[model samples]
Target: MRIYVNEIKITDDSIKCYTEESTEGLQEAGQMLVDSDNYSFAYILDNGQSYSYLIFVQETWSMLHENKGKKIIINDNLELEQFESEFNYILDNIQGNLNYGKEFVSVVEDTFELE
Candidate 1:
C-alpha cells in the first residue's frame, strides 16, 4: 500500500490532517484533528470508525507548542494491536527532521503493507 499525505491545516486551536491511500486504487484514507494544548488527537477512519487519544511528546516543545498537538492518520478497519504495530513500524522507519528537533512532519508517500 502507498500512503500519501494530502494536506495539513494548522490553526491556533487545532491541526487538521488529510491523507490519501493508493492501494487497490487512490482513495481518501482518513482525517485527524489535534486540539491545541490539550494534546487530544481525534481520528476518523475511512470506514467511519473513530478514535481519540492524548499524545505526549517527549521533545520538540518549540515545534508543537504553538500548534496544540499533532496526529497521524492511517488506513481504517484495523484492530488496535494491528494499528499500534503499524504505527510503530512507521515511526521506527521514517527519517526525522534535523531542523525541527526530531519532530518531523511532512507529506509522506511511502509503501506500507500490512499482513
Candidate 2:
C-alpha cells in the first residue's frame, strides 16, 4: 500500500498500515511495525495529506494483531482511485496546529509494549 505525504511518497518499506477482519466481519483498525519505531503521520489527512498509521498491540480488544506477512496490513481502504484528489484545503490547515503544538512533534515517538 502507498501513502502520500505532500510530494513525498511513503511505501510499505518504512511502516505498515492495515485493518483486521473482526469476528463480526467489520474491519477493525490497527497497524504493524517495530515496537521501537518512530512514525510520522501528517494529520492534514487525505486519502493525500492523511497520515496512515501502524501499531502492533498484544491486546485483542483493540483488534490489532501481528501475524503472518501478507495477511498483515501494509495499507488498506485509504488508497481509492476515486479519493485520489490532492488535499489542498486540508494541507493549508496543518500549519496552524504544528506551529502552536507544544506537545505534538512532527515525527511522533510512539513506543508500544508486548504486554
Candidate 3:
C-alpha cells in the first residue's frame, strides 16, 4: 500500500493526535492505531548499538489497527551516520520517518495484508 509521515500534534484538550501537514494547515483527522500480531521494532542502546525486537499483539488487540502508531528512538551516544542508516533502513524496508536524529521517530502506516 502507501506510507506517509503522519504528523503528531498536541490538542487543545491536552491529548496527542495525528495530523497530516498540508498547505491548508493541520487536518487532524482520526488516526488508526493498530496492535499488530506480527511487528518488529528496534532499540538503540547507550553504547551506540541497536537491537531489534519483535512483538505479537494477538488478534484480540488487533482492533487497534484502525489508529496510527508511533515509535521513538533516543540515544545521545549514537552518531548521526549510524542513526540515519538505521532510520532509513527501517523506513524503506518497514515504515517511514516523521523525524530523524538522536531521537528518531516514525509513524508507520500498516496497510500490509497478511493472508
Candidate 4:
C-alpha cells in the first residue's frame, strides 16, 4: 500500500473530498458524506508540515472520464503537494464544472458511494 504522510493511501477506487477556510462552497460540500456502495472516501485534514493531494475518483459521482472535473483541492490556502504532482485529480471525469457548479457547486459530487 502506498501510504501518504497522514497514513492515507489513495487509489483509483478511492474518491477524495477537501475543505478549508473561507471556502464556503467546498465547506458545504465537505459537510455531506457517504451513508451507504461501490465507493469509499477519506477525509484528511491539512498537515502544514507536509505536501498534500486529493481526489474524487474521476467520475465517481459527478465527474465522467473526459472533463477535468472539480478540483479535488478547492481551498486556496491549502498548500498540498503530492509526489505525483503532474496529474489533476477531480470530482468527475467528464462532468463540466460550470454545469455542476451552476446548481450544485456546494454539493459534494460523491456523497454516498461508500464501502
Q: Residue-pair clashes per candidate, as listed?
A: 2, 5, 9, 12
Q: Write the per-residue lDDT of candidate 1 for residues 1-115, one digit (tens) a residue.
A: 2233345455554444344542222223334433334322323334335233323232322233345334322232222223333344443444343332222322111212112
**How far out, in Å, is residue 26 in model 4?**
15
Ranking by TM-score: 1, 3, 4, 2
| lDDT computed for candidate 2 | 0.26
Q: What is the C-alpha lDDT profile of model 2 across 3-39, one tens digit per residue?
A: 3222112344322344442112223232222221222
Q: Candidates 1 and 4: which is better by lDDT?
A: 1
Of the pair 2 and 4, which is ahead by lDDT? Answer: 4
Candidate lDDT (C-alpha), each: 0.33, 0.26, 0.27, 0.30
Candidate 1 has an lDDT of 0.33
Model 4 Cα lDDT, one tens digit per residue, 1-115: 1112222223354323333323322122222122123132323333444322233332344332222332343343333233112222333321345543433433444332311
lDDT measured at residue 55 in model 1 versus the true structure, 0 to 100? 33
Question: Where's the lowest-lDDT run of ten residues in candidate 2?
Answer: 106-115
lDDT of 3: 0.27
The whole-model C-alpha lDDT of candidate 4 against the native structure comes to: 0.30
Cα RMSD for predicted model 3: 15.8
RMSD of each: 13.7, 13.4, 15.8, 14.3
The TM-score, computed over Cα atoms with residue i paired to residue i, of candidate 4 is: 0.23
Report residue 11 deviation for candidate 1 (angstroms). Answer: 2.8
